[model samples]
Target: MTTTLPPTHRALVLDQIGQPLRVETRPRPQITPGTAILRVLTTGLLSYSREIYSGSRKYSLPTPSVPGNGAIGRIVAVGPDATTLQPGDLVFVDIYIRGRDDPTVAALSGVHDGHTVFSRRMMHSEWRDSTYAEYARFPLENCYALNEKRLLGSPSEGGLGYTVEDLLYLAVQLVPFGGLRAIGVDMCDRVIVSPATGAFGSTAVQVALAMGASVIAMGRNTETLEKVRGFFGAAYGEDRIQTVPITNNVEQEVAGLSRFGEADVFFDISPPEAAGSSHVKSAIMSLRHSGRACFMGGQREDLGIPTFYLMRRNLTVKGKWMYERGDVVKLIQMVEAGILKLGQEGGARTVGRFPLEKWQEALDVAAERAGPGERVVFNP
Candidate 1:
């Protein structure tokens, strides 16, 4: 799938923080050793991206850097020893590309930084992390090739086999997928995804459901909740996937959700508006003894939990980062084996789209609470 390398291309550059992305024509990066170029197809507008744009989360990157972390595109050229990834291949641009390689680190410490996980940022170490451009360049390892008819049926089936958008949706799902794995979500667990039905919340709900756990989804909108409910069938009926709308008395029922059996995993991805003093309190109180809770994504206020509950409940609380190569591969395997279900077979839907030029509108929509089964994407 190799093609003639273009000299220049259009990109949405973040020259300054808290400012709108400006369209600019920049030099198309040339491929060096261990590198490849991706013609940006469509990148998702995740909540984190908006945070970076707003100058809230200070990334290690200095000013004038591209703000995107995840996207889906194709490799148009390859460098030395990078023969494994070819041109015209549909692949996912992982936001964080850090995984440890030093034998000593793996031998001594079981954990190592994986954006070491190639970030999808346009300016990662003098390389390109900006997928908002018409052309993006990155190390071969940062890109994971997507192939497998099972997960991606033939083109007409609303699968990745045809359009690149489906592949982007699959890539977006990896964020929560990685978090769930870190929290040890299993079939026997009762998972509660707070503020469910957004980019991360919706993805987590579906992944938990596929893993055989009963999901109690908490969201703010009834329409969005209904869309999540449509993802599954009678696999335990309504009891299997319970949707709760966020309200003043939300805690009354959230505390009772444990009645179906204590919650095993709680994903706190609640947005700012729905977040208040009660958010974390209800989440912690609802969990059973020794439950695992992950404060993954989303904005929340400083929450105070009773010290007695922390010590008595035997709860394991932790934070989640991004995914690894293994996580992405696991998602791919699930799709291929016909185990995971996406939009093609009636899962979620891409509700909004905007080209690179309309990044402002796209960012606004993505930042807004996404409607049920609706996700805003950037077609660069």
Candidate 2:
């Protein structure tokens, strides 16, 4: 079935760095082979959206682009090569797009311009337009269908009863899921998440708990740490989730973590401001023999790794970017199976919603509500 599409739609366009976003009428995206167009229901706003828009974050975004990373939407049309997806299907649009021929070349649609030369070229030449508009086009593989009936229908009518805004948590969950998967977190494994009060770190705790692993949430904020503990501890049992306040002193932090026993895995997703943080080292030192660690943080400074200690302990350390294609499918499955919850059940709440013209307000709210489980979205 094909739906009639308008020629133009309103979008929040970032004309260039350091300029205010403009809500302008733009031509609607046209579908091609291996691509699909979606009527975006909700696009999540990042907490640092203002920094990115103001050139403070230094993301290499192309000029005059619609900037949104991930969204939950309805499929409006599919390209000729498409087989399974159809019009009206509810799906989560993933922004991570890789070059078909050269998988190494990639770009985050509507977000980063790309780090490498090839990725930058791909971003500038194609995949630059993103989901922060009424309608957006995406690679066919990037659109994953959701269980529409179960997600949208009433619980009385055999549905999970989730709002479109609730599904926006998928975007927030994906990053931590990627890092956790990379470290091979398993059921019953004792895991430690450093700086677990932030958006991704807090979600890391959730994903870790959902995987049946016990989580030791470490962070500097006592209030937020307690909030995270209360949120998940209530569902998973207080004993299964533990919180440790990060003192930024390695010996003290390590001593605090040691009281919980050796952890099987240490997952760190610290932000740029957490450079040289003692939490990373403390968490690593707290791991058991043959333990694993995954770093998915934004710190630019080089970390001091205990080279001899890791060798002796047989510890495995790995770095992960966003996520793989298969990880997205698995994550959606986890959500559908009720193994991983969203919205109120998952401790997530949509704190604010804004229209395209109110992008600035949306960004501000997102920053203010930057803690775990707080969501701010655009109903574009």
Candidate 3:
């Protein structure tokens, strides 16, 4: 927490393609006048690393890019103009996404010319040199002020008593909550969210219920369906929030749940693939003349929705992504206020933790079927 803090630290650096990241001592990242030096506490992996390295997402940075996105840490040094943060401040910083253009970070992150507007504020990060390190630098705008006392204290002392295992759940929940918010999912409107067992699907159910919508959750697992109904409450109950069992006849199931022919909003969070695409197409065919549907999962292939149906029905299609800075802050506050319960509300739960060295394993767990609720994580 001082200027004389060690000048070098270990970072998980990705030096090239098709290679595992290596831990190496690098010059400790410096805090600019409007930036902060963060000693990362935990960082969550986004599933985008492969695309980042392959140059598939055009938005990805060049090689040697750092491979982290979400992180929570403590501020150890603060530059001038970084008045909102001080030494020892517990914070959550998004490393993948660039901060809003501010002169202080431009030079540090190599956007010094100010000519690259998109690079200055884009969501891509230098995945080759990220938070997998002992310490990292963050732009003031990219950093968030967390409830330090509450986050780090004992549960007995009013801390949420949470662990890093809570990240995926938090992320999934934020997806629907933030995504629905992006398109205005209002209360009391009918809603149908499908594939309710996946993280995003479960999140859509809880988010819709929280926003006062009557959610119709669909999934193949009977137990997961029951769990969804129970958690949303019997008052908001299974009847109002029923789950349709997915099968060969997904279209029939969707048509059955959409009796009113359409809901206020429809969510498709399962992997975007053949079965998933058909379900969405069916939802569109059966959606009310003016309803909206959102695609909330990663794109697996091209979505070939019927243009005629969308055009004729006046249905809006939207693609959802990670939370925006403002939305992330709002969600963090919701968690602090006890409004969003990560594990209970359908976020991933930790079944194991490893040192930063096992980041690949952690990623595998996150990518696997991963049991019913297991989320493997790394603590730096």
Candidate 4:
């Protein structure tokens, strides 16, 4: 049932490419069958957005738009054609419309412009964008149902309900999940993740662990490495979770890792600016012969993964774009069923939260690499 509607709502509008986001009261979005309106609860701040907003992300074309990448919301209304989703339904906006087999899927909905990342949805266009706003009207193609009650320790099970904080972690998780899934991580695989300590790396580490693979978490910072180790060490034990401090000495780290075991897969979630640094070559150095390595959400413009390892070590390298709807659904089920634990380090992953008016602070924090497992959020 549709509830009483509101006329206007607040949003962090990005009118210029490099300028700070502006908070303004804009007209509320209208709902149509192919579209639905959500009362945006919380939107995540990705570290990559710092470069994205700074105009440093060479692959991203600038447009006047909202900067939010993903968010959590309750459906307030849906168009007549959108009978699959209803009012009061809780969900996370999974904003990638890529790799869909059906040609007729988004052709009529105006989701993608056939120009941006992977010829997929731009996600920040005026027609369809992020949730850094009080209200959002999104294509049904970008909406994924997240059943909170199904979560372990939910209010129904004498636990606090799945909070907006959970939504924050889930929002950035799609990239890591999609990347790992693309290479088809297996139970017997021993994985190595470079720069596995930030928001993106943290999610990648947790997903790899949950997939039942033995993981070697590598990071340059001792503090962040230990923090990451504590998270995985406690649950999977040190035997299954190995933490290594990265250095320019790739051969030494590669030799050191041999004591634990060889890595079958190398999942690289390093920041784009740091993409071609030591980690790219080091990841290849650590992989076992015929081992698979996949670049997860790294920028290709400045990234240079050396081809020497592929020719010499018999390595298989692959590129994964975004994600599929089935992947998001599977992740949600895993989290709800208690197979995956987000921010399992016994503290909130939130670095900070801001009201819509204080969005600039949130954006600044979102771009910085100041803390471990930190996630910036906007409550609109």
Index of the highest-TM-score prediction: 2
Better of 1 and 4 by TM-score: 4
List candidate 3 segments past 4 Å from native. Answer: 1-3, 46-61, 96-128, 151-159, 164-169, 220-240, 248-250, 259-261, 272-276, 343-347, 369-373
Cα lDDT computed for each candidate against the true fold: 0.68, 0.89, 0.63, 0.70
The TM-scores, one per candidate, come to: 0.83, 0.98, 0.80, 0.87
Tens digit of per-residue lDDT, candidate 4, span 1-380: 46888899887776665667787887888876677889988777766565556666643433565556678888998877775788888888865543345433321111223443434443334354457788888877677777666542555666435566766667566778888888899886898887787777766777888888888888888788887778677876677788877775767676767777668999887665565466667677777789999887454455656678788889988876556677888887777766776653323477788897886677688777445567787888
Better of 1 and 2 by TM-score: 2
lDDT of 2 by residue, 1-380 (tens): 45899999888899998999989897899888988999999999887888888898878888878899689999999998899999989999999889898987778888787789888887776687898899998999999999988887799998889998889899889999998998889999999998899889999999999999999999999999999999999988899999889998889988889888999999988888888888888888888999999999988889877777698899999998899987899999999888899989999998998898898889899888888888888999
Q: Give the TM-score of candidate 2.
A: 0.98
What candidate 2 gets wrong by more than 4 Å, as runs, is none
Q: After the best TM-score superposition of candidate 2, give how far the Cα of residue 22 lies from its true spot, in angstroms.
A: 0.2
lDDT of 3 by residue, 223-270 (tens): 877876776665345656866666647568666766654677778776
Return the candidate ranking by lDDT, descending: 2, 4, 1, 3
Q: Sort by TM-score, best first.
A: 2, 4, 1, 3
Q: Give stretches of model 1 more than 4 Å off.
A: 1-3, 47-51, 54-61, 99-124, 148-162, 233-237, 248-251, 272-277, 344-346
- How far in Å is the alpha carbon of 348 misplaced in model 4? 4.4
